[model samples]
Target chain A: MDFKELDPILHSQLRLAVVSLLISVREAEFTFLKEKTNSTAGNLSVQINKLKDAGYIEVTKQFSKNYPQTICKITKKGIESFEDYVKALQSYMNPGGN
Target chain B: MQPVYCFINRLFKPKFQSMQSENFSPKDSLLLIDSMINQAKNRFTENGFLYLLWGWLIFISAVSHFILLKTRLLKHPEMIWMSCWVAIIFQIIYLVRKNKKEKVKTYSDGIIDNIWMCFGICMMVLIIIVSRNNLWIYMYPFTLMIYGIPTFLSGVTMQFTPLKIGGISCWALAILSTITLPIYYLLLLAAAVLIAWIIPGYLLRKKFKNQH
Candidate 1:
């Protein structure tokens, strides 16, 4: 098994997908990321918390029209991690698995 | 008659009335709050100063142009030309200063907005210079029409109604100036400023201010 240093929690396909989407989207609400990743609220919340704890993404809560809001944005550290992940993933996919 | 009756009855009948159900709930109230927060977060992430700069410059210039144009004293051809140059100098400085802080790739829309403002300023200078060449007096109104075209285009492109209104006002005044008194040019300038610049500027300022 060709493997490289990767965050165990983020190595999963779904979390990786979530991080990728967040990086490009500037900022996304919990609902939008849920729809985009096709993940349930419980699953996404757990993944987001993991990312937030890692300092890869920042989550802010606010009120809009008397309703609670949670917005997620990818951090600079997150962007760096994503780039590294892509490079590592690329190495794994190469013909010789270098 | 029976077939016609049957067709009419079929058309009037509500299809899928039984299938229609309110089983799904509306979007969560919490999501909207999150969205607004998200929107704010994104706005902050983007170049906030530059967006304000682009929005403010267009609006202020439009308003100032309208107000100054309305004054009978400013209608003096020499005064108009002098004021035009001063405004240009100020704008060139503003543009240079604003450019310093702006990162080219981060705010593309702001760059486009700045381009339009520059075009408007350049056209104003050209209009003033051409008016002095008595040889082009016959063509002066035409030049004015040309001047207004950029304003109109900028307005439409930016979705700022005032600029569009100003542009139309210029064309109308260009037509009106040919037969009417020179003082009428002043009046037309007033209309252009009011319609194209001042009102819209006020609206934008209010809009962004509320967002903060």
Candidate 2:
């Protein structure tokens, strides 16, 4: 897949932030992502839904300690896309994939 | 006993709630929370470093055993076992270091992982220095299986396919090693442990370090 084509999705800072955090953690609760991104619940939820629609992440809703919890996990496709996005970004920055 | 109260009441909530929202923005709250998390992460990193040190202590001891195997000291198997105990002492120190770093203590998989590795180390050492009969041969496969279980679990917990694959490979090799116990099985056992545990241990240590 040509990652340059994914520039629009990858260019959004909030979406990029979501992917980066997910990469490290493998999975995170919605509250955790909300706090980390420092974005409003509405905005964060919207972006997460977008990523989910894109097949980049899977959202699982569950209960923890009687509290509703939403968990997000990046898929293999997401990982591949993120790597490609990183390469594209690097090329844009350095004019070389290196 | 109530550490939460100490943090909320004694530390910040009084001054925080007293101040006007105009004076203190949510950005300030974010900064405070970030600092708190950073400190927590630093503590975790230190604990991970201590764990890595424990693994390294065992690695060094194993290497020492290799060297000692060739020398006249080979005659003194009890002395070598004593040295392994010394390594165990260092491992205890590592455990202490890890325990001190984490406050909200519960037995997580990391504790289980270390405990399993410790068992494997002890059994492997006994097989080398004490057990002379054919029954000792089982220790080779047993240690391999013990070492692989935690590795596999950690991989599943973290959702990493490569690590999961590595763990399965160790299990498969352990079985194969058990079956293929021909001449020089001791050397083969060493090679298997190194591949199964040591290499993955190093990779895990490195991965844990980077995650921090």
Cα miss at A45, model 2 (Å)?
31
Q: Please report the candidate that would top lDDT against the real structure.
A: 2
A65: Cα error in model 1, Å: 39
Highest DockQ against the true fold, candidate:
1
The interface root-mean-square deviation of each model, in the order shown, is 17.6, 14.4
Q: What lDDT does candidate 1 reach at residue B198?
A: 54
Per-residue lDDT of candidate 2, residues B1-212 (tens digit): 13322322343344445333213222333344345344333332222343344345544554555566655477653254366577668778766655443222222345555655775667667676636665655655665666567656655654545446656866776778756843333454455445545565566667767755
Per-residue alpha-carbon lDDT of candidate 1 for residues B1-212, written as tens digits (9 for 90 to 100) = 24433332343235313322211111221233235334333432222233244334433543454456566445543333345556558767876765433211123245446666776677667756766765444444664576476667756655667667767877887888789665345455545445555555565556556644
Query: Residues A1-58, candidate 1, lDDT per residue (tens digit)?
Result: 4434434444544566667666555566777677756778997898799899999999
Candidate maximizing TM-score: 2
User: Each prediction's DockQ?
Assistant: 0.03, 0.02
- Alpha-carbon lDDT of model 1: 0.55
Give the clashing residue pairs of candidate 2, or none: none
- Predicted chain A of model 1: TM-score relative to the true chain A? 0.88
